[model samples]
Target: MSSILRRIFKGKDQQHQIVIIGLDSAGKTTIVNRLLRSEFIPTTRTLGVNYRTVKYRQIMFSLIDLGGQEIYRNLLWQPSLEKADAIVFVLDSADLRISEASKAFWESIQQNENAPVLFIANKIDLPGARTFDTIVQDLDLTRATRSSRPVGLFRISAKTGENFYDAFDWLADVVVGSESVFKCKLRTVILIDLDSHKIWTTKFSSLKNEILDEFNRSISETMHELMKEPAGMEVIIASDLQLVVVKNHPLVVGLIIGYSDSVVRSKLIAERLMNTASSSIEIGEFSSDVLTKLLKRQWPLDIYKSKPRSD
Candidate 1:
């Protein structure tokens, strides 16, 4: 039965092409680097398109960071949309004419009716940064979404690492959500030791030990290749329940969910889990059964069935 279910739930891990489009000096490359390294690095303007792949959990996000110069801005979105799963439109939040940037953003997405855009309000760490509600009002995002499908805007500071995980988590979930069944309720809360790579999971989980091993190994390998620890509120928005992974030092806590959990839930639970695991465990005292029992005692099955707070 588990094997059959695995076969049924397969094929959502295909490489997804996500292009990062924004104005020149809007911190496009810096945002990608921040996702890669979790810290700000000095960057120059992108002369042409910058291509990089972000391997997160089961998906390889082919992040095409396009050069946003006036000359290159004219290159139309039709060609890019031919293969993309989603559009990630980034804007310079501190720019005085944010509405102008929004206009350009709508213009780009309108050209490709197929791809849903995840609009990012970047550079929020800078002075004069605009608020998310302000951008929505100014950009008329409500109007934009009314005419389109699956559009979302988020306020992110790539420089300071605020709300980056939440945005990326939703982006991945949105992309995968269109393909297969994404658990709208919580599915899995995996506790993996960064040092030993042992896996502990939640109930009714379909992930086999071998499959779980792949996810486990990739965590460290990804961190090594990207020079970024799996820090921040890391969520793997898989095709099933959206996967949220929060890393605290030695222990990484991954939660797979269906609906958008409230901001309070997403941040606090994963954090508290990470803290509990890191602070409680001994070197060789870990096992899947033991952790599962402990998790049930602490979290319980009723917790997973609870409806997530949308507002």
Candidate 2:
């Protein structure tokens, strides 16, 4: 097995492996760079696979950005397949010749009995790009239904950062929920279920207690009138350091806290969260609730929540 595969399969740490594959010039590298928030001019080809680590909502991911050249297609199986928690297949919406390559990559991922896959039709900003409906029909993904089938199909513009977060968030959800099926090492991560309004975190000493206390305090402060309602709380200890809490109907005005090695990085993320909240003035009711929860829990709560005492 390659070193990349070995580390993913044999490592003692909990890290979700996601592979990004598609046809050449399908904007795979562009999407990867956009996700990483880095700027490097496009190169000819990516040898083997390039990897990067990204943290979203306290979930750490090892994203493997694979080359999409025809010569490298055969190298995608075996070692790479052994440890993937999810697969993202990108397609060039404007290039018919390369669309076949995207389908082939999807087929390889389907052969793997691991987690589900996400299909992304990239380069939507291009004029000749195929419509999402056409791509879905041509890929036959709309009719595709397996217990572990592709969870979603997205049309995106990597250059414009459109629909990127939606794709990444979907992958993160699948990775956190797929139990020992992929032989993945459990790590210190948190899973926030928007539908159920719950949060699941890897148990870590006093971390769970600290988080819960903060959450409770914030909810009480933000939704004082709503507290009389029977709020649901489900706590599960998967291991010594993992705690999963399902809090029903999370309050909209609660706090969001995030931890990172550097204070500067945390501050930057906080600023972004503030901007998002400010710009979402007209979002729908459901979206507003979800956004409020994400902002309150995933960003730096210490900087945002400052309300009067609730005596």
- Can you tell me which runs of candidate 1 are displaced by over 4 Å? 1-13, 76-78, 178-268, 271-294, 298-311
**Where's the lowest-lDDT run of ten residues in candidate 2?**
180-189
* lDDT tens per residue, model 2, 1-311: 89999887564356778777887788877877765542234656677778888654345778888777777777765467667787788888998874476467567666676667788888887999988888777777755544545566778778654555556556665666643211211122333334345443332223355656555554444344434443322212221221212133332222222321222232234334434443343353235455546545664233333231221
Top candidate (TM-score): 1
Off by over 4 Å in 2: 1-13, 38-44, 178-311
Which window of ten consecutive residues has the lowest lDDT sum in model 1? 178-187
Could you tell me how far off, in angstroms, the CA of residue 15 lies in candidate 1 after the best superposition?
1.4
Candidate 1 per-residue lDDT, tens place, 182-244, comes to 323445567777677666776444555554565556555545532255465544433333455
Q: What is the C-alpha lDDT of each candidate?
A: 0.67, 0.54
Q: Estimate each model's TM-score.
A: 0.61, 0.53
> Scored by Cα lDDT, where does model 1 land?
0.67
